[model samples]
Target chain A: MVDDGGLDVVAPIGGAVRDLLRAAPGASVDLGAIDPRSTPGLPDEQLTGAERKGWARRQVELVGRDLARQQEMLFAGAKVDPDAGRRVLLVLQAMDCGGKDGTIKRVVGAMNPLGVHIRAFGPPTAEELRHHFLWRIRRALPPPGQLGVFNRSHYEDVLVPRVQERAPEHVWRPRYAEIDDFERELTAAGVVVVKVFLHISKVEQARRLLARLDDPTRHWKYHPSDVDARARWDDYQAAYADLLGRCGTDVAPWHVVPADRKWYRDWAVAHLLRETFDTLDLGYPPADFDIGRERERLLGTAGPLKVNRS
Target chain B: MVDDGGLDVVAPIGGAVRDLLRAAPGASVDLGAIDPRSTPGLPDEQLTGAERKGWARRQVELVGRDLARQQEMLFAGAKVDPDAGRRVLLVLQAMDCGGKDGTIKRVVGAMNPLGVHIRAFGPPTAEELRHHFLWRIRRALPPPGQLGVFNRSHYEDVLVPRVQERAPEHVWRPRYAEIDDFERELTAAGVVVVKVFLHISKVEQARRLLARLDDPTRHWKYHPSDVDARARWDDYQAAYADLLGRCGTDVAPWHVVPADRKWYRDWAVAHLLRETFDTLDLGYPPADFDIGRERERLLGTAGPLKVNRS
Candidate 1:
């Protein structure tokens, strides 16, 4: 099984997986150039179908445990010092049938839910529409020591409005810089903004949608609106490429994952988190009190003590 | 080792564990009479220490998978019918060193974080104090289809104030009836409230506290206030007994779990969740759209389509 090779005790922390996946800053993105079926970091050529999937699943689980431990430290550090302001926000954006839900269940689900907060942004309500585009997004930012996952996010403002002609160029164009500034602000305030775009081939999406339609249990996942969205696939791809190029920042570069393979998609996302957490160099918060004195006091007070009932 | 015996597909669901653990409504609770070290339904006597612990860990994992499946069905059901209002709220109450955190990490963490919302209620903030005691709680109640876990809940109002004499008898006394009414209202609103009290012996608590003091990594979990709370263990127990007797209702009963053994504590909580979910009898929401038509439409649209960019 593809484990972390005991990273907690001996192996060096994350680097290679991230290096393979991260989009280069200032580079123009061409979605057509990236292969949605490629396994960037794995030795895929040597493995059979089941073996590759099993390897990816094992890697996801291993990296998830490491993420869980790092998150505990993040949570513990905040408990010790509320002013630390350290937190992580993961922003996931994908086209329909691009494996966002699968990634969340297989990868993000591995963490202790106590420290994970998830918010799925759908179409705006009447109340939400009246506010600024980023209003709802800001409200959902993870608090100190939390790992927040946004299933579809403020990027929707740029994508849907532009593709559907709901907003003019002047309105949605500035949102790119606005989003960059907003993310930069979040980064400045100690939030590590991890952005990922799940890259799925249009053919794969059609296959997945057909499967959803074929299965009664999966019917809840499909809708007529999905077909409408599929019809605008090329426009959606163009919009995604624009956002990927414009939103890439020094602190929060966008990673494009080949999401046609469910296992690799889940593994890549989990590995991305592992690599990000590794950079934090988080340690368990130090014992704030006198350990020796507290231990002695604890040992001395072995007898039951009474409270005044009055 | 100890699985759910194929509860999903083959066997009957959810009665035995719940029946073994529920506190009888209106019955007087005797904290001292309950053995904190007892493994109520498990055959602990036949197994050695490691074997027993291993069995508990395996049971927790197995039941956790069942809980995960049930939660998915619940989420899917709600997605199909937003008005269904079906949701589960798990209220966890325990003394310091009584394994509330352990239960959350090992059991609740087993579910997908996407569907699990956890709120740890500590002392109320100034904003919270300005509102009704249930106001903050009402806001944190799980929305439709999600599993919400409250670690140390509104029962704190009754326990802390009464034991510490922060509120006069008349002021704090009526809260029992008030809490009962509040929970009843929640039950009427399609929420299944699973209340659990982790019962730990004072001697065991002292040992856990001493262990915290002995380990630097765990010191962040300890506070001097915990020692003070430990000093008043008897008063707290009395307060717990009172609330357990008064607040338990037909729809929402409280279960008392022996929590001296960490593995058993986690397993029991997971089992409790499994039993609760079983009663829900949740199924995937039916496909509102025409499956045959959608399948044909999906198959017809197999070719790459272009979007108008103008």
Candidate 2:
């Protein structure tokens, strides 16, 4: 079992899930070898398809409650210590139709929206392009007591440019070090970086894309160019493998979530977050002012005001 | 019952909740007439206090689910037409310990964080004081297809300045017209503004503050200075009454929620959101692309990718 960062509470699923899902530092990922349907930390059971999905949904809900409490503690801690520098940045990177939005809805959505900062980084705008790639990212970092989610993050810089040939090898290769250095600085400043790569097979992508087309309501999500990305499946996988291998660091590691089953994918992401928060050993901050004095002063206040009747 | 706006689905609550809670446009508000313990939209039941709270909690959860779906429709509609200019901005204003944070965590927290933009307005910084009072607020308006919440809002300018004598009446007085014109512009631009005043009794506020002081874990929330604000409750109430009377308009109305009961406060705010979204007649936007052609292209893509086993 992986160590529970420093959480006093029992983890929903032991460190086993996070440990199993964590992409080893400096190890190459082979998309084919990881079964998208495999329930990594869940026990093998004789359950029907519907039952499995229901079970997974329930587990995610439970994890969400725990996450909500932990998040409150994180926010409270930051409030208590403005200089705490304790914050979480969760980076979600996925291919087209890989369920990044779904993961966010089910997992991050569970936290109080007040303390969560979500930024979906699409293609760089003209203004964004004028600055360094990390400029927009740096501006969006969560403050002392917040959970920050990047639906698509800086890793896109490496994956997209490399596969689409939008940038040269010399241009894209050094981004790994640039990213590492940036993450190192964030870690030093008390940011816990959790990077996740949603691994969906080419077959699953086709199914999801087809489902979107079949449902008129979902058509807004589908684009003709999604096929173009799928057409370069092999190239994109190679690019991802390289980035996952090179960028996975001791400070901020990558977790590859098999994305074939939507239910399993949602639960796994929430599990990863629960474990991450656990490691923070979060607790509520002590009151800075004199509690006894405050209580006396508070009680001394007058009762409900006598207002003029309407 | 109020008009259902254009909603195709049944509202978790009829218009009674919003209608009853609404602060009539141009009508002066008397804090004394409004009973903080009254459950405005609920049935006069034969249930115990615990049962009432339990019922409110469950009802809030149900309303939240509906709000989630409606919010998705709002998001989808926005995506289908970025120019739709359709968004809901919920502005929350309250006294100290008035349950604004609790409302956000329990009510706004029900929706996905992806499409919700939240800003908590605090005392102005040196830089913020340099600009027009509304400048910071204008910058935080929700983009199309999103839900935006203001924990404390532009109304603060009218309330704090007038009550605390931070600015002379000449400066703070005309802000009513400025705020009305600003909100008018927002309404013209397709923003549906839902303003709420979390009305807590002074006794309840004192009780809450004492509870915070009593709990070591809650000490971070309590401040010795909170009593300072409590001391000037009457001034703040008069300030709130003035703003509520003037700012409650047709385009953006104010809802005065009795927040003595935390559970009921959560349900009330959530129900307000549900009714507001329903009135907008939110729905998913149709696919912008050629669905039929995309389906053919997606299906023609090769099956599961053939990758070398690790």
Candidate 3:
């Protein structure tokens, strides 16, 4: 077990801890070795299942408040800072029924909707497919002072095509390098990229799928092809492992979150988000106007009301 | 003055009153005949300056709240309705210092930022000029459930090019028809277009320009070319007149707001916005999930938590 200080820690995830979470660049990733049930950085694992859920719930609430505050500061800073081009892009990648929607609602849903934008990528439309893969993604990037969340990002281009044998190795292999360069350019342009891979065991996914089947209201979300995708689980895992190894860079590292427990998954993602914001060291920008004069003017208790007439 | 049925009124701006405010399609617009000081629907206008200001302020506050509520409904309706393709595009066209920014801050700013989007168009970049003039405009259009405010929109294509002779008459003349078709298409696609022409006297503009020059803080907003634009005021007015006459269709009419008084302008715009939302007849969509069962599951007081194993 990795020593992660404690669950209540509220500092930037840096150095060894960040490195441990990241799939090392250019190194082989063993998906089987990393247990989906493991909750890294969580203390006292001896606690009962119910106790662990309660603890994670408390952590999520605390982290949610912190994340909201930091987001407000980021927005306030952009108002007055001339060089306030900094923004965040949180890319979520996962297998079918791996809880991407749940993660979005519990994690990013905590931030002010005004400052957060969520873009879910489904199959490309005819117009979208006409453009290069990156074109649509570039257009959907968050403007300054906003957090952009991509439910399934450009990574899907490589994943789906490779697994389904739609493209030969020659076509999709170079895309790993392309993705790294794209992420590097984004970081250079002041967009911090946080990519999360929600790791769920095949058994856990089947459980979630069955739950969806049990709930009549969630029937709209069910797809027949999900079973076919499940049949190719090993192929998908191989594609993911290759991606995590090859595309993971020092600038835009990937965090593999153990997502078997919904509460723990929410807590971990929220904690990482708060840590990212804290690392940004954001503050409110300086006031541009004469605050005293403007205050008096608005209150109508100052000098002559300045009105221009011919 | 037209009776607005008090400040609390929430009906569509209709009949002869709306006709009085609109620049009729295909009819020559007499810019001189339309008084800049006229406040159409405001009651008891014959009062002291302070009293009129107070009354307008109260009306703006009330109308602003109503507009906010309507915007909320529009956003809510989108959540449950699969075919909720409703959106709004407020296209603001005016001379420099005609109060587009102020109107945006006071009117749309009162609505939830999540539902409202503002795009201020400056001179086109090289990339933008490469495409058709409408390309960038189309991309920036608000998606469903959004209220998009375009400060100085595609109308600039007709006005600037014609007055400066940047393009020959043949080039800009065809654009009027293009604009009419574009707006008609938007209306067909469920985008309610509210076009406003802020009418300010040249003398009033000069006064405002001088004020910008006098204030050190507002120096960045000032431009010497603004004076040059003012010198060609009659040419701009002619171009604007042509636009109002030619492009004002029954589907997308133009409101010629007399904007010499800032408070009255805000009130009128806010009132019109509230009326637009009311005409839309938006309501919250029905819940799509089983609220009671989901509540029980979340509370952890119901059926056994389902889990699957391979």
Candidate 4:
């Protein structure tokens, strides 16, 4: 019964609309179900299914290239100004077989290291576990003007322990509230987080595993025991579903990408990034004062870098 | 004079041979030119420039994926093995517009983040300047099984300020001894150090700069004042030439890559990384013990993890 207005292109789940609005203000968006009034600012073309995925891959490459280019420029100016530090925190997360690495390289491979700071989190050290679950992640945040991506994030506190039943029920369950609060603070501090769950079917993951084992170059990737984690698939999926249902928020939303399509995943990330950067009110630094005027002012003043003893 | 041998498609440099020898006790090595013999054990095709880069990038991707894989796997057999900690510290330094980032992305992009740590140094912060030049750098040394790339490194102490007269005469001059000693300590501490200087011509940089300006996305990479530094091209080149003359050592030699051809630069880094990893006797982990034997030991002991005792 909703108004079918512009060029419609989203599914009825409301994720794409939520993602766009969360990424950029005043971004009027519609997905496949509605016929929108205009498709001017739509991230992807109105194509659906396979065609849309093809377009998405090319679009992701463009967005990633654009992101790298912008980050490099802003960083070069860091010696002069620090304002370029406000880009969004793009966090990529998924289960054991999720394709975060290939996705990151394909999407942001060309970024200048000097511009974008990448931090990958591992399991808790003795000290890390002693503190709140979010402690380690908070410390690794990208300083201003950088796109910081957390490979596995604070969500682990809620996600894994719940599925594994490693922690007491009450302790792990309450963490969802804590996470929401922490994200709000990050947003308040100018960190916009885009959390993505790359949803790949178990069958696809099995195929990838087989490929890794068959290829010599990929032999390094086959950790003989990844099969054990695969056994817990149902438990993990239920946990992630609970996570997406509860933690999806207006400030920082979860994008449950149907990652069966790698091209579509790349396109979704690119679309998300463009929206994030387009919203930031960022530009070139202000000009330096006129050298002649500064010289005249220096002559008018008795004070100098070296103060007189008198 | 070094003996002349027919050049091979790929050959070992002196630094690599030394590290290989260091890894295996009593292993003999020759450093004069590419040693005459090729290892028949290594599959001939296993030694391509693309394969080398593919391996390292694959390792990094494996590490990143492992970290993001699942909580249990990250901790299952984790911790930087103390023995492997004596690995190399490979530093890549280049001219302002040279392709250091490209070198890393193409070479080690596949390696796991767990095995590599990267830091790019520009000007020192006020707090950093309070200590010795190497003070900040020492803290960034890579742990075991890791590769570290420094975009512009402490060599700048000699390369830049020395040319620009940014420091006093005695202060800048003696740092040559100071730097040599600092690296000697790293090598002595069991860290293999291979340093490179990607030498790009002024004309090449100008072309890249123009390219950056012409593309709207790339425009973010432009800053007007970088032009001021580019104007000092001749002096900086002289400074670099002098630096190479003084600092090139048997332990940590410099590879001056002619970067006009971008693919050639990529190939060089790929070759260098493969050479580095090939040196390590990265033997597989000790065999997993029989679960039945370990189970009895665990049952006989104080049992599963003790929470605590007052």
Candidate 5:
């Protein structure tokens, strides 16, 4: 199913994706918009969200496997690159318990450890809260040719603080501009920032929360605050609404996937990645110096060695 | 720190680690056991569990990074190991939402993906459950010099199936022996199996569950089924205790890591890894023929091609 003669690697990379990100800077895009272009389409009219998620999970696993192979090729004297000085930053933020860990598992599986890095940000460390919101994030940037993933990211400046009003409204508001500038810098300097907001419905979230409590294997995963937040769902929704309306720009827009169905989410993510890599136009760099050319270059300039027999 | 220097490299490759597994197959060794071997008079006034865990997390991060570098070096130019039949299988199981994902992140963060493989098992698909429990797991064993990490594994045959009563108690109970046999077979075949069970307290689980609900960005991560398991806390604990008590073995023993503290869990995993790799004694192979040796062998044996023009 070639969309346009071949794998239609659409979804603006250096173009619209980057441009919109730059324009809004801290804004998130409705990444679902990139659908049809990503997975082509599945003909299962009867598939449930969970089933879709399973399929997407498999797709992600395959993508992760692909990343692993690419990494091996690089180690084999290949000059594949992101040209991004040192990292690919993945930002995953969703309502509490949004499967960030599950997403991380499937997405990063089979990746080269040397070239992939993961940083998870929880309630900010006291030291973290004291600094500018982006401080912890800036420190986690992946080294060149590396992929750096953030379980939660600087977006929390907008997300958590806004939803909880933990920071004075005024303090948290300026962060949008600051985040825009920071991401812009990262993009211009070669870092491709991919942000995913897992959009699960409130009911699904409640269901997952209850699952945590019911599964003894999951008991350690429960928390009282989760019940508390369930009470404040409305506030979070309003905050998210404001976020979507505000942050999506040209340089580093967020990809808001409908996480209500994980399969769709996973497929969407892999598709996005395939498109991004295609856009980078990545290829093995020409050998340091062509061996043939190098031999010829020395052929005429070299003199014969002195012989001991003389 | 030395833990009795019984591991001698003179033995064929992988023999030392294998021997250790065979000896302690049933004893659940706390791989993260911090020895005071060198600190004879150190005070025992340790930080509470939380602080200790924090320190452990930092330590694991450092070690994971180092491990990552080593894997990269090996992949760069190392010869294919002659004892290339050995591989590693790391199995991590925990109460729901315990730091399984984080453990993978910190532990495998630096591993070279060229040879390592990761698989996460959830409730089996209809196809998987229809056959023997070991079907999916048996397929993922890593090749020699490679690593295979399992997030949740065959233990589920004993863990979840027991709690849910999906099969008769007799069925799951005996599967434990089967699992032991399965892992034992893996070890005999050169698989270094290391298993970890993160044990978190009920209170801690409550805190994490709450965190998911409180954070809007993390909301989709919760599920209703989680609560159902929590209500059956006693049943799960019994299942875990039975599995731990029965399955902890000399060849593939479990590490009962106290999970109240996340950092400690991380530290313990990193330490377990260091011990596993360091204990393996992956020494270099004998050198290939040098130029002199090559010349001797080549006195009559012509090399590739003589320069043109003779």
Candidate 6:
């Protein structure tokens, strides 16, 4: 029922949703100020859990279908106009167990894999460490006509080093400028950058970790370092706040999505993606060849038509 | 010095060199038929080890310079003629302790990192396993104008599965044809596929592994699985032979580079790359803007320009 208007009305609504979720640039972030459990994008009305779930699911499906259609046009446009140089890169940054993977699955997984490229950054390999932090990230960048998603991205270079004291202040402090320059260049090169920071409460993370441990199927996902990371939760939050304030430029602003509620987080991300695609205003390229003549020629071919009946 | 003629003479010589090093497609590759220790591309005259090393080094330097220049032209061509869709993808496959890394360093490392993209495949991640083997490989492909190097590649999907019995015959056997189709599509899409198999002797691999074990600093490179892999050397060789014979199409052929001698392997790879670039027949793109006028304008403007001495 929620899919009636589909992405027509949803696009503008999604813009409003993004404005509500966006973490203002240069503003000092107080994790306490944002309620992670709140679903600001959803209708402000009383509803049962099942109803809310159904509503979110329907919204996601509608948004996902619209997003898929936009992506197809984007890809088609790229193929026809190779020099047009249009692309999208969605960068997702979150704390340990903060739903980066979930966001990728719920938001990006809905699109065609052919048009979507996902690069999940873990600890740098020996070879990756040999180059600048941005080197590997640059290599993983999606070319024109593709939607590139960075599960954990170049933002980690700033956050991890600052939070873990891995690098000296002089070394890591300069990175904010470096990142700004990198994103600027990316935008100039026709990459539209959309950065989202999935904001999850510390309590939610602990609960997720405990759930992982409780379920045998999910045990492989649990890491001891996650607990260690949890110990420095406040430090990580501070680092994230600083990152949000510094790296959030006009070209690539950071959106702090409330992620404690999985359904809301999924819905919010889908909405954001739909809004981003709408701004691109992409359309399928005109047929390069005579389709009517080709169809007649195909029909005139001397061959027995084989039809599959299953 | 071997750099006397530089790239001008070396470019043509490199073509001759490739012919000498190329493994004849459809030939039953007896690993014994090829001498891994031989430097086929170098001079036949006897020389001291130091002299030989110097000669090889100079040759690599010349070829590397030429390759870099060609890559610059290739990148420029892409910028000017986006639809030209010209690109090169070098797939390097080798046994354990083979000179894949060394070859990449000596050959590709000499070029501009911006123009050279390297994707070193390790064991597939959980996400990678969810899709087709070529899924990740396809994503890492070079866009027009760039040279992409796959340290290990989709060939592994065939070799590893066959050697270790990781998959049923029904599963892995069809991959040869699958690979053929994949490569044909790549070639059609303007990607020049250069597949190189670094042919190393079992003795050479053991020696390299032992050397790794002997060095305290190199312990990270050693693995118990290396020994396990070495134990199945004959099986891997058979797999390699089959792959070479089957997938070596007119569009994408396989070159078996004798890789027991690190110096020879490096020089040969550099030569192969130089030849590949030469075949592209690339030239620097013409300046689109009025450079002469811009130069005059700069000279006419602003008095007493400050120059930094740092």
DockQ of each: 0.43, 0.52, 0.06, 0.06, 0.02, 0.01
Candidate 1 on A1-310: residue-level lDDT in tens?
3342454321212346667877876636888989998878776555675677766676677778898889989999988887878999999999999988888888887888888889999999999999999999999988899999999999999999999999999999999999999999999999999999999988888888987877777888888999888888899999999889888888889999999888878878888888788889998888878877777667565776333111
Candidate 6 lands at a TM-score of 0.52
Chain B TM-score for candidate 1 = 0.91
Error of 3 at A132 (Å): 7.8
Model 2 residue A30 CA deviation (Å) reads: 2.4
Q: Rounded to one decimal, what is candidate 6's iRMSD?
A: 29.8
TM-score of each: 0.92, 0.91, 0.59, 0.65, 0.45, 0.52
How big an interface RMSD has model 4? 15.2
Which prediction has more favorable lDDT, 1 or 4? 1
Identify the runs in model 6 with alpha carbons over 4 angstroms from their true place: A1-15, A46-50, A296-310, B1-310
User: After aligning candidate 2 to the native by TM-score, how far in Å is the CA of A211 from where it should be?
Assistant: 1.7
Worst 10 residues of 5 chain B by lDDT: B35-44
* Model 6 lDDT per residue over B1-310, tens place: 3444344434333336668766666845666788787777576354565677666777787777788778878877886677988999999999988888678766776665545666778888999999998999999898788888888999999988888998999999999899999999998988999889999877677667656655543444555566667667788999898888888778888888888878778888888887788788887665453445433333343234333111
Query: Residues B1-310, candidate 3, lDDT per residue (tens digit)?
Result: 4343476653323333345588878745888998887777765444555576666776677777777768867866654553757888898989999999779867776676656766768788899999999998998798788788898999999999899889999988999899999999999998999999999877677666666655554544555567667768899999999899988988899989989888878877887687678789876554455645544433332235454331
Displacement of residue B297 (Cα, Å) in model 4 is 24
Model 5, span B1-310: residue lDDT tens: 2111232211112333223232133323333242211111111134343344334444565667656544433332133442646666788888776778677765775564444566678789899978899999987565465567887898877877778877788888788889889989988887788887777655455556556545543434445456567666667877776677678777777766655555556655665666676656654333232434433332323224322210
What TM-score does candidate 1 get on C-alpha atoms? Answer: 0.92
**Stretches of candidate 3 exceeding 4 Å from the true structure:** A1-135, A142-181, A192-310, B1-20, B45-48, B51-62, B76-84, B124-135, B215-217, B287-310
Per prediction, fnat is 0.61, 0.78, 0.00, 0.01, 0.03, 0.00
CA lDDT, every model vs. true structure:
0.83, 0.83, 0.76, 0.58, 0.58, 0.76
Looking at chain B only, the TM-scores across the models are 0.91, 0.92, 0.90, 0.69, 0.75, 0.91
Q: What does candidate 6's lDDT look like per residue over A1-310, in tens digits?
A: 3443344434333337778788888846776799888777676354565577666767787787888778878877876676878999999999888898777766675665556766778788899989999999999899798888888999899878888888899988898999999999999999999999999877677667656655543544555567667777888889889889888899998899988888788888888888888788877665554445433333343134333111
Comparing 3 and 5 on TM-score, the stronger one: 3
Candidate 3 overall Cα lDDT vs. reference? Answer: 0.76
Candidate 5 residues lying further than 4 Å off, grouped into runs, are A1-58, A70-86, A289-310, B1-310
Candidates 2 and 6 compared by lDDT, better number = 2
